[model samples]
Target: MSMFLVRSFDDPKGYIELNRPDGTLPRTSSESYVPWGVSTHGKIVYAKTGEHTGWRGGTGQHRLRPYDTTVSQNRRRQCQSELGVMILNNPSFTAKAVSKVSNAMRLYLQSQDAATAMACIYKQIGHYFYTGGRFGFGRISESKKDDIGVDGVWRGIMQALLLGRLDQKMSIHDAIGRKVLPVLKGGQLVKYTNLATVVRQDWFDDPTRRGRVNAPVRAPVTTKGGISKLDTPAGGTVAQGRNRGVDMFSRDLHRTRDKDADAYYDDADARNLLFGAGISGTTGTLLQAGIAFGKLTAAEDLKQYTLAIIGYLVGGGMHSYHETMAVASKVGVPYNPGAFETSMPESFRRSGLYTAWRANFYDIVVLGATHWRNNSGYLPSHLNKELTSPA
Candidate 1:
């Protein structure tokens, strides 16, 4: 006789199968086998080969038998329930709203010649500098003539364009790093049900994922005394503990403080410092050259307006290209302007129109409030004083 034992961790009493030497036997309770002494949380199967009356009186050596096992239905149900909850709480909806707003703001600003408006604002602030002739080492000496001349126009145009570019860069960075990338990564997490799977898929889809997967790989800057100079990722170890995508959003929004200097700098401030200097220097040099060679002339009202429009386009285009290239490089994707065509038809939809209208309305309200504030009190008076002050 031969006996086999079938055991499962979830069951305390295991079943047994008995067979005769001819491999045939009538199934009966007395012929069943029982485990003598074994305890485990995993499945185990044992078999005895020889004549046997029962498990307690078996006269043969016992050996393990193999069998297949399946995942419990309860576990699968739990996974499905978790997935449903995650889907319900997905952040993509909010991200899409933010994206629409950002795009709309970009369109509205472009429509209104933001660069020129920015230049006019700067002029109001810088009237004192313009009045002070030969005030600095810069070659554009203040003119004795009261009217804005070629040099002044070119300076204003360049400075305004620089500011506009800085603003556009900051907006794009915030929208992408804070909103777009996080939503995308979160969607992948929900789909894959694992971080490693999502990371691998991203790597496969775009090799540049290694560079821009929102993983905090960079070591934080530290002072000579080993104090951290800025806010770093929350993980005690690099790139392992925290959710990289969420941490990235936090880092982007984190404001850094200069303890020694008693100064505060946020992401916007840092970006401005990095991009503003380069844009201003490059554009200023170009404008100065144009003025020196008589390529640029004094602004008539129409010409001033035309120059502002041109400045807006040039400044906006350069910044857009820069942002596109940066993202492409980080994500291992080709920069393709043609991809925008896919969404062109949707731009005419009612929702799109509403978003556009809402964005423009926001801009108008902001501009009107700024105008009111500037015209109301100390600002206008101070500007007037600066304008009237002698060189």
Candidate 2:
């Protein structure tokens, strides 16, 4: 979210004005460099605070927050606030993935001779990444491991480490800022790691169920002289989308104007992350369905499932279900949208199993069915009662 003013030492042109509330105006002075420890950059030009156009001074701004200087209380506050959020957001698949594996263990212990443990384990694992965190039996109070941790923690950590390879694949913009800028500015501008890229790494690889970054790329640039020269030979960063992990799913898919046009999956990694955190295999699926519905599902399916799930979850009656079905039949695609709108019920839709199927290939087919229903003027009132009524 931090905006930076970028300029090359080699440029011969005049000053560039930043668009602010007042108007676009040139920046003047800049301060001596100091490192922002959050990135690899050894230093930053501290832009001075207060909005002023043109070259008033060379000092750059340093972000600061005024606070009471009580040492003991502040220490505790920092640990509880800043450190707590950091741990939660640090993208540790180990802690989370273990939670799901542990849940599978607990279910195995409880079921005894009744169920297949491996299937339960796989389903739980899939559910966790899709949902991003755990729910139901996966809830913190009900978690199986208590505080001991899962047996598979080491393996989970290894997988997270392996996926970190994607983090090393720099975006064209990032490489320009980090690797290229150092040499360009006579080494004065300094190379700093982009926070957006770091956050994107966490956001993209996160198995924590429902998370996604949907913002469009604000600026685009072709690589500079030597960089472009080398990139052409190296098979450069020519892909679409902001994050490499996110862009992986976009291959061969039709591009959309929407920010997350190509992020669809049969099951998302976010589910696994959550399941690892102790959410139920089932609950994770339901939450992933909501997120996937918003970001990844087809448009026609969006209209149908939004109405259907919202109606069911909100305690609307058979009549509401009927109305939802009516709209869905008219609007949803039949075959390509996933499962049949006729097959979805208030209880079943919230149950997690149904939503899991929807996240896969079923929803696409169902979207096609919805188009057919819309064209045929089908009334789904009777069908809703027949399918959704307690069986």
User: TM-scores of all models?
Assistant: 0.16, 0.20
- Encode model 1's per-residue lDDT on 239-311: one tens digit a residue: 1111111122122221122221111112212211111101111222222222222223332221221122112
- State the C-alpha lDDT per candidate: 0.25, 0.24
**Worst lDDT 10-window in candidate 2:** 270-279
* Candidate 1 Cα RMSD (Å): 28.3
Total clashes in model 2, counting residue pairs 3 or more apart in sequence or in different chains? 70
Task: Determine which window of 10 residues in candidate 1 has minimal summed lDDT.
Answer: 272-281
What TM-score does structure 2 among the candidates reach?
Answer: 0.20
* Position 123, candidate 1: lDDT: 42
Name the regions of candidate 2 deviating beyond 4 angstroms: 1-42, 52-105, 108-115, 118-254, 257-391
lDDT of 2 by residue, 1-391 (tens): 1222322222232112223342112334553211111111211122222321122222233222211122212222221122112222222312232223223223323343323323333233323322233331111122233131343422332243234211211111122233323333222132122222211222133333222323243222321111111223321232121212211121111112122211322111111100011111211222232222123245433443333232221111111122122223332323222124443334334544444433322212122122221122222323222222212
